[model samples]
Target: MKRAAELELALAPRAEGVTLQRWLCGELRAAILAGRLAPGCRLPSTRDFARQQAISRGTVVAVYDQLIAEGYLSGATGSGTTVAAALPIAAAGTAQPRTSAAPGIARAAAADTAGTDDAATKRPRLSRQGQLLANSPFLSREGMVLGRPFSPNQPDLGAFPHALWQRLTHQQGRGLRPDDMGYGDGAGHQPLRRAIAEHLRYSQRIDCHAGQVMILSSAQQALDLCARLLLDPGDTALVEDPGYPGAARLFELGGARVQGVPVDRLGLCTDALPTAEEARLAYVTAAHQSPLGGTLPLERRLALLAWAEAGRRIIIEDDYDGEYRFDGAPLPALKSLDRHDRVIYLGTFSKLLFPALRLAYAVVPEWLAEPFASAISLTVRHAPILPQAVLAAFIGEGHFARHLRQMRRLYGERAACFQHECATQLDGLLTVLPITTGLDATALLPRGSDDRAVAAALGAWGVEARPISFYGMGQPAPPGLVMGFSACNEAAIRRGVATMAPVLESFNAAAAGNRGQAVAGV
Candidate 1:
């Protein structure tokens, strides 16, 4: 028997929201199951473990009692404690116990659910739609190293006015009404809805009132609610190729057939929009095409509206990063062109304020407002009210506008620096596309060059460049890197570009050599 002093048992620091006893039990159980604690191995006294871990002896005793009840450990008044000799997990690498005298081992095993049959422990089956959502790329953490240089669609979190936001938060907390402490309205705080309505009207010529706005957790939530409310299984939903994967995933989650329409320099090609017979809905990033930063042209916008009107179809216009257009006067949102009231416009504070805020707004037609809000209520109730109130105050007091102006200028400078550095450093390797609006920009790789491979190579070097191919659902777009400069400062952008240059050059050279070899073989 190993001495208690030689056991070297330790507990990991407890995680938030978990009790000390539960944490200790989980760690000890893991040790037993992984064969780290052999069968018949004596455990330290609860008093000794409590002293070593700086936890209460009662908690350690409780954990041991619980583990014993679950058949993981065997203990008696005088026998101290030992790992269960007859644990069923022995076949899975845990050693069989050398001693069978441990008290209540058999009785505990019979009582414990852990000894249940394999069929009882199998994972629950998912529905077909649930399977698609489960395997979604949107949930993938690949290339999602936050604060890394050129991480696509990421805003400059370092530049957010944290002090100002905290001040507003504190003010809201102080002024909260008793009603504010309760579950909030499904449509969100009235003041925030009004503020958003006013801001949209003034900035984007969107004709809306507070009644038409529904605030939810994030743009994804808003889209999910839209999918739940609007799409039926086997129905067709049109999404742009090389567009937001999250939206497509949401629509697919509702069992809708997500058909990707092709996009070009001017955004989604209106000429290619199929007749809206089976198509129930269309989603577009009209302000600036996602992955490829091109504003939808007025001609295409009018044509799209015409298409929706002709078929009584719903159009979801995601103006996700429309706030920072550096080129010309901002175009009115596709929502503003909805004479037929078929457009549901979505906007997010995640891009504008910060991602962690997790607040976004949706402007639906009068007919759909109640249902939409009800769906949100039935789903998530609503976004936290205090943050909603604070954002309302932020917009009403002019801080939102001030911040927008500051970010636009800062991001513009970063964009320019990024493009210049790309031109100087990656001249022969790739071409950085012209940036007009949005946080990220696309840089097309040399024709036939492997964008995914290049992106992987760059990721290994600490640069997070998402390949554009990851966004496509249909015909592939040009091999390109969707790199963001907004999250990275000018120096980091320059450094990122410098790092990418040599790697791209080597790949390009190899590709050329491979082409020569192919031609020689032919």
Candidate 2:
């Protein structure tokens, strides 16, 4: 049997602020859990320990009684005290002294850390879908905080009506009903939905009612819901070859087999539509094709709708930056031509108002309305009601329309500035495509020059641009840089293009040298 003096010598120093009884109980428990005090080992008698510590015997007895009750030890009138043969719980592994800067904890801590890695390895791995989503571009945390020069798809944050928006938000908050603060209608605020429907009718010429619209946290979330609700593993989904990578990644994460349909200067090649029997759905940015900036011609729009209707397939039309088109009149949305209700029109305030709003809407067919609402409830509960209410007021009061007009003028001038600077500084080095619509301008690199390397080089010099190859989805896309003008002012656009001139020249020169080497080898 271990003596009271020997046990006391092994105990760690007690901490401050803990009761004496707790300190003793904790040290004993730690010792037992750490396996330093072997199972069934005899313990010192309470009376003896009390004498050793110069405390009342009652305190020692109380500690012993509590530990025995917790199944850490066993005691009876004649049994003397002993550690339990069977513990009720797994070893706590290691522990710190109760609220004290106690010595001797280092040994126990070492024991704890030794098992940390082993314990982690024993845990289950991420599911296949989870692993795919984890590695997908949609979930990437890079380039999310955009405001860097020439970043694509970002709106002019500086030109947004912050004061007016704040006023509307404050008004809505003050006037909110008690019900407004609770979980909102899963379909979203009725007034906001109505406002959106009316806005679409006027701007995009889409014939939708408030009942068909469901507000969501973002266009991405809307697509996620669509994927979960409509797609099963191995379903064939078609997206533009040089299209939005986020959409393709989302469908892939949902276990859909995503195929890239080639995009030409006029957008998705209607003649190249995969047979109706082949694809289940197609996602398109018809108002302005993403990254490439092509507007789908009316004939192709009709052809796409005909194919979807004939196949009973779905078409997701993302009218992301339709309001900012500078070329002629903005074309009617693809949904406006959907005679068979196959098109789901997706729109977002993130691009129009600001990204932080995180508000977007989906106008689905009547058949999907209820199911989509139910899905929204399961996925996000509902988009916050207060922002919805404020947006409703903003649109209803004509502020949203006014703001859109202001942005159109502002972005138009910036786009012109961007074009002029590129023509002046980069005429020989790069081909600057016409910016007919959308926030970004796509400039093609010389053939065989690596756009990705150029993009990386630009980042080092404090400018940002997405290489077109990133959106190519393993297919061949024209190598280029997508430089956004919407987020930058005229002066910033000039400076960005000026900075880009030398970088592109260097890459072009390098490509020429590489070509010369190839010819010499031949």
Candidate 3:
């Protein structure tokens, strides 16, 4: 009796919007359905059941009476309530469970009911990582290859200069030395590194020699490599509270403890940085704080440098989308001002040249270059040679610079149109973030709204945008959308936002109704 009571207590649901009687009844039913509470298994007395569940005696009696009435169990004045003998049970040695099917079998059953064939039924289950990556909320509705819906972080595939890329590839390929096809330097192909160095100096005002540059697959990979080189298990790293999920996840996965420092208009609140004992690395997006679009003030930049110097902590500066500043002339990258070599500068070509390129580079300080080079050698050897050669040709031939200039002008015009449409159409319903330095656009909607549901509704309307909450580590995120406008033109931007407006209104109304219910409850 004591063992049965313990099992009942262990299986009980936590109190959440459910009466004790309702919870107990549901648990008992689930147990019976799952075959854990076998048919003919007798339930404890009402008083004992109530004691085990920490509920009133009347609640248990009510639950037992309900189950008995439902024909799931039987009871009498003296005999305890027992699972009914007629309840479904698996035949001995049968593959299927007696009552309900397992997930795989259930899915197969569902497919069969829908007339799917055996070939479809035998499909493998999606791995946890695969499922997570596939269902990432960042995916959009416009760019899916199979015409299903857009996947988030998808670049404007139509905009890629494939013809020019192929031409450049052929042009570079014709002159490739036999050794160029052989194992190259792990730091990167020299010409490509030199080209990146030159581009950074000319465009971003960051002066780094080719030796300091190391090519990696993407910004996330760069961060992961940095984490491996710099962090040890249980070491602390500071991250912006509402910052990049990729960086935060990588740091946590690398066995490093992460502290979420707050961010304001001027970027990461340096004053809020944990004490030296708490943190050894600070990851920042100073050129444009993601989702907020606020550039770190020059004063704060200097303060951060000083803090890093004093504490001997390293700064991983993710200069993602730094080239597309629409407001004013671009600010110098933090690496340009790092006389102490404490900054590991990361930049990506994904936003500019299309994400499919998978090209990004990190500028390591001279002292760390050798170890980083060795790390690269041990890991990915070097970036693919052909892309590097094509990029080098793109830079050397001046196409890259011209492309940046052209895109800047186009993005500026589209951004203006987007802002105008938001102001005109949304009016008081939405607030657009002021700065537009990056390839992305952000707008804050009213709090308490379901941004994910709103984003999904907009996707159904053929417009894709990411919910601002998707970027946050946890809840209470400000309601907003982090919209990528570079791939979309003015008309597309206006149409997308227009489509999104009704969804936003529906969310706002639902939120208001919820608030009303809460107030009435109070």
| Candidate with the greatest lDDT versus the true structure | 1
Q: What's model 2's TM-score?
A: 0.81
Q: lDDT for model 2, on a 0 to 1 scale?
A: 0.84
Between prediction 1 and prediction 3, the one with superior lDDT is: 1
Candidate 2 — which pairs collide? none
Cα RMSDs of all predictions? 6.6, 6.0, 16.5
Runs of candidate 1 with Cα error greater than 4 angstroms are 1-121
Off by over 4 Å in 2: 1-121, 139-141, 276-278
Per-model lDDT = 0.85, 0.84, 0.76
Which residue pairs does candidate 1 place in steric collision?
Answer: none
Model 3 clash pairs are: 90-98, 139-152, 140-150, 140-151, 140-152, 141-150, 142-150, 143-150
Q: lDDT score of model 3?
A: 0.76
Better of 2 and 3 by TM-score: 2
Worst 10 residues of 1 by lDDT: 94-103
Ranked candidates (lDDT, high to low): 1, 2, 3
Candidate 1 residue lDDT tens string, 136-197: 68554453798788888788888898999899999999999897799888999999999999
